[model samples]
Target: MAAPGCFMEHIAFLEASDDPAATTVWKEHITDDESEGRTA
Candidate 1:
């Protein structure tokens, strides 16, 4: 795959839905956007 142009474009995918490790990352992301006054 081609490299992403921006730093935020970099992504590491976790396929398991119930995985505990990815939970906090996703929560942090959502909270960050909410704190910044943005939407999904």
Candidate 2:
């Protein structure tokens, strides 16, 4: 697992990007991990 601060920074970077697809994919990946009881 990533350090919490690093994870948040990565998320912020993704959100700041112009690529919606990348952000959407990242969100979906996080959702899937959560559903499996895994930490992002």
Candidate 3:
């Protein structure tokens, strides 16, 4: 498992990236978690 800080950094990097693929990936990640009743 990734450390919490590293996971947060990855999320920050995804948010800062302008690439559409990155945005899609971020959206999918959030959606999956939300569906599982998890909060970001």
Q: Could you say which candidate leads in TM-score?
A: 1
How do the residues 1-40 of candidate 1 rate in per-residue lDDT, one tens digit apiece? 3223433335676566786665646523434455455767
Report the poorest 10 consecutive residues by lDDT, candidate 1: 1-10
In TM-score terms, candidate 2 sits at 0.22
Clashing pairs in 1: none
lDDT of 1 at 12: 70
lDDT of 2 by residue, 1-40 (tens): 5543344324444457687775665433455456446875
CA lDDT, candidate 1, residue 18: 89
In candidate 2 the C-alpha lDDT for residue 33 amounts to 58
Model 3 per-residue lDDT tens digits across residues 1-40: 4443344325444356677684664333554456456766
lDDT of 2: 0.53
Scored against the true structure, residue 14 in model 3 reaches a CA lDDT of 38
For model 1, the stretches where C-alpha displacement exceeds 4 angstroms are: 1-8, 18-40
- Which candidate number has the best lDDT? 2
